[model samples]
Target: MRERDIEIYLRDEVKKIKGRAYKFESPGNAGVPDRLVILPGGRVYFVELKAPGKKSRPLQIAQQKKIASLGCEVLEIDSLQGVDEFIAKVCEGK
Candidate 1:
């Protein structure tokens, strides 16, 4: 599926887990993850949605590392099963 389709599916699944997923945009912050997802209990995750069988761009990977360095979890999702597993893991919590 396309990146947008995966994003929509993941956002809908997030809602089922009582979370909110917002399209992330930042002025002058190119390569940032596509979505900022916040779950119950203040857990937060940044998601970069990609087309099936695709990988993140170099700059995208750099942005993910930058975000992770600040102590937030970042997820790269490219499939329906990835979204399902992400939802389940988030709901379960760590």
Candidate 2:
């Protein structure tokens, strides 16, 4: 499946568990990741979805690390299952 396909899948799945999901779309964000999901309990997660065999761009990697360093959570995942784990931990309001 394509990245968008998987992204939509993840969004819907996460919503079922977390109550809401959002995708970030800036007019000219050249290197930002695909989505930002906000859960019911006021927590946020930055998700970068990629197809199998794909990797994050350098700037995107740097951004993810920067977000993590700020004590926020970011996930770079290739599979929907990995995304599920991320949602459960970061967005599911456990």
Candidate 3:
């Protein structure tokens, strides 16, 4: 799916689970993924919506690697179920 489509999907999915999807913006640009999702009870995460069959943008890839190296969680999703799984894992601490 395209990035815009992914954003809509994520926004709706977050709502379904009572979480809030916050798009992380920068003054010039946000090289990271399009959003940071925060759930109730202090659950939170980063998700980059890379199009299906397309490679991640160079800057996003670099940022993701950096975030990983720093011990942060970044989840990439394609289908709705993947988003569901991301929330479930974050909520369950699995």
TM-score of each: 0.96, 0.80, 0.77
User: Between the candidate structures 1 and 2, which one is better when assessed by lDDT?
Assistant: 1
Candidate of highest TM-score: 1
Error of 3 at 91 (Å): 4.7
**lDDT tens readout by residue for model 1, 1-94:** 7889999998899898788999999989899999999988999999999999999999999999999999999999999999999988876774
Off by over 4 Å in 1: none
lDDT of 2 at 93: 46
Cα distance off (Å), candidate 3, residue 46: 0.8
Off by over 4 Å in 3: 28-30, 91-94
Give model 3 RMSD, 1 decimal: 2.3
From the highest TM-score down, the ranking of the candidates is 1, 2, 3
Each model's lDDT: 0.92, 0.76, 0.75
The global Cα lDDT (0 to 1) of model 3 is 0.75
- Which is the better candidate, 1 or 3, if ranked by lDDT? 1
Lowest summed lDDT window (length 10), candidate 2? 85-94
lDDT of 1: 0.92
Show how many residue pairs clash in every candidate, following the order shown. 0, 0, 0
Residue 62 displacement in candidate 1 (angstroms) = 0.9
Lowest summed lDDT over 10 consecutive residues: which window, candidate 3? Answer: 25-34
